[model samples]
Target: MSMKRPNVFRGYAALICAALLAPGSPAAAFDAPARIEQNLSLNAQCGLRAFVHNLNGGLASARVIPLVSGSSAQTQAAGGASYFNGATSNIFSAVTAANLQANCGLADVTNLVQQGAAGAYAAAASISLTFEATRTSNGDRYAYRAEISGAAATTVTVSQTLVNAAPTVTLGPPSGPNSSGDYTVVATLSENSSDFTAASLTLTNATATMSGSGSSYTIVLTPVTDGAVNASVQKGAFTDSGGLGNWFASNTLSFSNTVEKTQKVIAQFMQTRANQLISSQPDLTGFLSGSDTGALNMTVTEGGGAFGFASAPDKGNGVWARLSGSWSHESDRKTSYAFGVIGSHVNLSPDLLVGGMIEFDFLGQKEGATRVDGNGWLIGPYFVARSPAHPLFFEGRFLYGQTKNDISPLGTYSDSFETQRLLTQFKVTGEIAQGRTTWMPSLQLSYTTDTQRAYTDGLGNFIPEQGFELTQAELGLDVRHEVLLPRSRGRLELTGGLSFVGSSAKGSGYASLVVPEYAGGRGKVKAGANYTLPNGAVLVMDVYNDGIGAAGYESYGAQFGFNLMF
Candidate 1:
C-alpha cells in the first residue's frame, strides 16, 4: 500500500504538467519575455533583439530605429562600441560607433550603416540619444535608447539594454620567480565573453597549450630558444552570447619565453643600484658651513635599508673626508650591501680648500634562486674644490670610478667583468642671518654614469653590454632657528627646507628587461635639528623625503649623528 501511494502522487503531477503545457500556456511566451519594464543588463553586446525586447515589448506599432546615412546619433551602437567610451555626452552628433559589428555583438548592424543610411532614414516618433551600453574593463562601451508604439497608439515603456564589448588582451607573467622555469603565461581579457577560448589566441615562435574561462586563460609554451614568446587574438575569434559582435584583434604581448637561458638579465638589474651609484656624497646638508672636525652617523631609509656615516674635516690642513656603509634587506629575497673608505690630500688657505680624494668601495648582491650571488669592488679618485666663506659657500667634486664584478649565477659557473663610472657634483649656498634665524638658499647639480661592458655567461648566452646614467638638479632654501639653552650655554638649531627636485634616469638600466623607469620632476622636504655644546661638539638629527632623489623609487630616511670641531 505504501508503494502504491507514491504512484498516486506521481499521477497527480502529470495532470498539472499537462494543463500548464496546453495551448496559450506555451513555455515560449514566458521564456521570450513579452515585455521588460526594468532596465535590461546582460554580459552580451547590445543588439536588435535586445532593443526590441526592451523598447517594443508587448507594443503593437514597431519603431523604426535606423542610423541614417552620414547620420551619427549619440544613442546608437556601432561596431558594438559606445559612442562616448563610457563618458556621457549631451550632443547628438558628437557620437560615432567605433567597432560596429564586434563592439555591439551584432552581425548586421545595418542600422549602424552610417554611409548606407546617410540621409536615408529618420525617427518619426520620439528618439533617445542615450540608453544602455556594453563595457570592457579597459575598452569602450556602447548603448542606445528607443520607443515602440502599438498600432492603436498603445504606449510601451522605454527601457535600456546592457551588453558586452569585445575585450582588450593583456599577456602577463605567470606566477613568480619570474625567471627560467616551467610557468604559464596568462592571457587576460578586459572583459568576460561567452565564446572567447584558448583556441581564440594565437602565439608566435612557441607552441602553447592553453586553459581557462573566456575572460582569462593560461598557456604553457614551447621554446623560442633565446627569443621571446608572443600572444594575441585575431578578429572573429568568437562571437558574443548575443550571437553578434564578433571578437576583434587583441593587443600582443612579447614575453621573455621560458627563458631557459642564463642569469645575465638578473645580474644587470642588480648592478644598477650599487651603493657607488646613488649615494653621491655624505651628509653635507647639516654642516656645510662649520668646520666640524669628525662626525659619526647612523640612519635608516625606506624599505628597511640602513647606512652609517663618518667624516673628518681638518680645517688646518683642508680636506673633504667622508665614509659611509650601506646595507639593505631582502625585497623578494634579494639583498645588497656596500662598505667604503676614503682618503684625500688637501691644501688649506684662509678661505679656500682644494683637494683630491681616493676611495675604495666593496659591494655584494644576492639575487636569491633564479640567479645565485654576486660580489664586486670599486676604486675611484675625486677632484674636489671648496670655498668655505662665512656668508657664502661653493663646492665642486668630480669622480672617476673603475669597477670589477664576479658573477656566479650557477653553482658550477662564474665570470668576471669590468666597467667604469663617472660622477660630477656641484653646490652653492648663500646665507642670510637676521636676529636668531638664518636662511640659506642653495642650488645643487649632480651627474653620474656607468659604462657598458661585455661578458660571457659561460652558458653560451652572449648579449651586448648595457650601461646606466642618472642626473639630478635641486634648488632649495634652508632656514635655521637657534635657541639659547639655559645653564649649559649651549644652542639648539632647528632647521628645515623645501626643494624642487628634477631627475635624469631616462635611459638607465636594462632596457630589454622592461624594468620600470624612474619618474621625473617632483618636490622634496627636509627637517632637522642640531645641538651644539660649549665644548665645540654637536649632536645632529635629520629626516628627508625626496622621491625625485630616488628617481621614481621611494627614498626617505632619518639619521642621527655627532660632530666635533678642533
Candidate 2:
C-alpha cells in the first residue's frame, strides 16, 4: 500500500464494519456495498474468524434474497403487479412483518427472516394478504394490514340521522264532488309536506288507491263506506328531501260520513227521552215529568178504569203550563176525581228542577154502612237537584191541603168536619249503574199532620166536638232495577220497597168517625212490568201489598198510555 491508515483510524473502521455486520440492521445492509466498492471491504483482511463471520453473514443475506426474487417473479407473472403494484407494496411489506412476528420463534431470529420471506412471496403471488400484529413490552411491535389486487378493497360506512322532532299530520275533510261511492281523502303534513309523496297511508274498512301527492296527499277511496274509516301511516313511510331523515308514524285518524240533520235530531231526542217502559208508577214527585205537550192515560184498578189527561203547553222561554185531571173508582163503590195545574220552567238550570201544583180532589164513598163525601184542595211545591259529578239526587216536597167532609152515621151520629193537612217529604236516590241495565236505590222520609174541626150540617155552624188530630212519620227504602230486552227493544223494570210507619191519633171523635186504625209499623212490597210498542204506546201491570200488623191493603192494577212528542 502505499499509504497505511493510522492505527486509530483503522480501529474505527473495524468497529464500523462490526456494527454493519450485526444482525437485524437494514440500514447497514443497504450501505455495506458502498464500502466494498471503495476497496475497503472488511472480508479482504479478516482471518479465519472473520471468514466464519462472513459465512454467517452470507447465509443471513441469502435468507431474504430468495424472498425478493420470488416476489419479483410473482409480480411479473401477475401482469406487472397490476393488483399489488408499487403503490400497494408498502401494504404487502407491513403484512409480511406482521406474519413474521406471529409465526417466528423467539429462540431463532432466522425463523422470522424465513417467515417474512414467505409472507412477502405469498402476498405477491395471491395479490391479497391480511394480518394483525400487536406490540409487546419487550420491544416487539405488531401491526395489521391487508392488500387486495385485481379487486380493490372497498370500505362502506353507513349512518343514520334522526329527525329533529316528530312531525304532525292532520287529516283534511274528505274531498268530494258529493258522490255516494267515490271520494278522496286528503292529509296535510305540518312539516316537510312534500315528504308524504312516498308515504304509505292505510285505510281500514275501505280500499285506498293513491291518486296524487304534494304538500298534501290525495288518496281515492272506492265504495265510500259507513261507520269509521281508520287511517294510519307506516313507520319510515316518508323520507325528507335529502333522503337522510324520515317522518314519524303519524297518529291514527278517523272520519265519519255526514248524517242528515233531521235524523240526528231525532236520534238525540230518542236518546234523551226517558224509558217509560221501565217505570211502574206515575211521576208522583213530578221529577220525571215528560216534555210532551199533551198526554192521556187510562189505568184499570181492581174495580174500574181511571182516566187522566195532562197538558204541558210551552209558554215560550223555557216556561210551560202544566194542567192535569184524573178520575178513579174502586170496587167498593168509592169514587175520586182530581184536577191540577202548575207552571214549570226547566231551563232554569241543568241540575235543578222546580215546580208547583195546585190541585182539587173529590171523594165519595157509598158502601156498606158508611156514606162519606169529601172535597179537598191541595197546594204542593217540589224541587229536585242532582249533583252533576255524582250519581246522587235529592228531592224535597211540601203539601198543604184543606178538606170538607160530611159523614153520615158516624158511629151513631152524623157529622160534618173540615180537615187541614200538612205533609213534608224528602227523597234521596243514587244510581249504581248508568246504562240499559241500571240499578237505583232510594230512601224517603215523610211527616204528616192532620187536624179536623166539627161543623153542623143544617145551620152550617161550627161545633166544638173535640175533633181528632193525627200525626204520622214514615221512612222507606226502595230498590229499582231496569233491564233492556234485546229482541223487543223494550225494558223490564223490577222494584221492591219496605216502609215503617208510626202514627198517633187524639180525641174521642176518631173512634166515632171510624177512622182507619193507626198502626205502629208497616211493610210494603210491589212488583210491576211494562212493555212498550214501537209506536210509543205502553202497557203496564202491577201488584202491591201494604201490611200493618194483621190489617193490610192489596191491589192489582194495569195501565195503558201513549207518549206524544212534538
Candidate 3:
C-alpha cells in the first residue's frame, strides 16, 4: 500500500526519496524491513536537523517573517505555514531588526515560532514534535530538539552558541539656562536603559552627579564657568542586563549658560515764534485779516540789552513770508546774532486749517576770546481747528532741524547737531460788541532738545559735552477794545495781556557752562495798540516785560510795526 503525501510534506518527502534512490551502498544492501526502518530513522533525523538549522539561522540573523493578511489556502500555498502565521516571506522587507527589537516583544516571536512548527507538521498521522531555542543571555548557547511518536519513537537534539546583540541608546531633552541667566542642567536617557548606571555618565566643562538606577538615570551638571556646558555618556562604561558589554554607545548633549547686555541715550533743541500775522492780528468779530487782501508789516523789539527786526508779508490766499534778524548781548559780554527767512502757506477750510513752514537761520556768538558759529534749517507742519459753533480753537506744530557748529578755538573739534521742537496751544475767545471788544484766553506748551557734540576749550582741547533739553509753558489772557473813528472810517485797537510763564532746562556735561539753567515760574505783561489809518493801513506797537523773580534773567522788550494793506 502507498500513502499520499500532503503538499506541506511534499518538499521533505522528495528530499528523502532522492537520498534513498541515490547510488548509496548502505540502503542498497538492506532488506524490505531494514529499508523501512532505515527510511523512518532517516526521515526523522533529516526533518529535525532542518528545523533546528532554520530556527537558529532566523534567530541569529534577526530576520522578520513577512506575515501578510490572506486566506488560509493562500497562506498555506505560499509556504507561510513553515515559519509565521500566514507569512508569505521569511525575509525582512518592511521592518529592520532594530525596529522589531524595539517594537515587537519577545513573546510575539515565541508565539510565531510555535505556530509555524504546528503548521509545518499538521499533515503527520503520528505525533509530530518541533523545537526552537533562543538565547536568554549574551554569549549563550542555542539548544534545539525534536521528538516523533508512532510504532517507533525517535528524538533529535542539537546545540549551537551565539554572541549577544548590541544595545541601542538614545538621549532625552537637555535642561540648562535660557536667555534669562538661570543656571541649571539635567541630562537623561531617551532609550535603552536595561543596565544603565550613574557611574557611566561623564561631563566636559562641567561636573556631573547622577540620580536613579538601572535603565533610567538623571545627571545633574554644574558648569565650571558661564558658557556652553556639555555632558556625555562614557563609552565602554555601559552594559546590558544580559552582561553584554559596550552595548550603549557614548552620546553628548550641549547647552548654554550665559547672558547678554545692551545700553542707549538720546537728546534734542527747539525755538518757536507765532509771527506777526498770527500774534498781532486783532480778534474782531466779522474781521478776516488774511482774506481778499495782502499786507506788509515790520517789527522792532528791544529788551535785555538786545535789539531785533522782523518783517512779514502776506501774499493773500493764506500764504505768507518772513525775514528776521536778531542780536543779543548777555551779562557776560557774550554777543550773538541770527538771521532767517521763513516761507509759509496756510490752507483754511471750514473744519481745519493746515500749514507748513521752512526756514534757514545763521547764528554766531562770541564770548571772551572764543567764537562759535552755526547755521540751522527747520521744517515743520502745523494744524489749527475751530468748532463753527464754539469759541474754542486748537493748534499744534511739529518741527525738526539740523545745525552744524564751527568753533574757532577748537580748530577741528566741531560737529553737527540735530534738534526737534513741538508746540501745542489752545485759545478760547468771547466777543462783546459786533466788532468792538474781545477777550481771549490761551494756553501754550513748548518742548525742545539739542544733540550732544564735542566742544573745544581755549587750549584747543576737545571736551565731551553732552546735550541738553528745554521745556516751557505759558498761559495768558488778552482783552482788546476798538474805538471806531467816524471821520476816518477806520478803527483804533488797544490790546492788553497778562501771561504766566514756566520754563525748565536740563544741561549735561560742559553744557552748563555754555547754556544757562532756566527753571521756575514767571509773570509777564503786554500792552499793544493797532492804529487804523485813513488809507486802510494799520500801525501796531507792543511792549512786554517778563521773568518777574523766577528766571535766570529778567527781560523787557518793545516791538513796533506797520502793516500796509492792499
Q: Taking the tens digit of each residue's C-alpha lDDT, what string does model 2 give over 251-311?
A: 6766543221112211221111111101111243334323244555566555555555655
Task: Compose the digit string of candidate 3's lDDT tens values, residues 216-303.
Answer: 6665666675446766666456766555455345566766432110000112122222221123222212122222344556666553
- For every model shown, what is its TM-score relative to the native structure? 0.50, 0.40, 0.42
Best first by lDDT, ranked: 1, 3, 2
The window of 10 residues in a row where model 2 has the poorest summed lDDT is 45-54
RMSD of 1: 24.9
Candidate 1: list runs displaced more than 4 Å. 1-276, 283-290, 300-320, 339-341, 348-351, 370-390, 408-414, 508-519, 532-540, 548-566
- The regions of model 3 sitting more than 4 angstroms off are 1-295, 300-319, 329-349, 409-435, 455-460, 512-518
**Model 1 lDDT tens row, 446-479:** 8876654765556555634666667778889989
* Candidate 2: residue 269 lDDT (0-100): 18
- Model 1: lowest-lDDT 10 consecutive positions: 114-123
Worst 10 residues of 3 by lDDT: 259-268
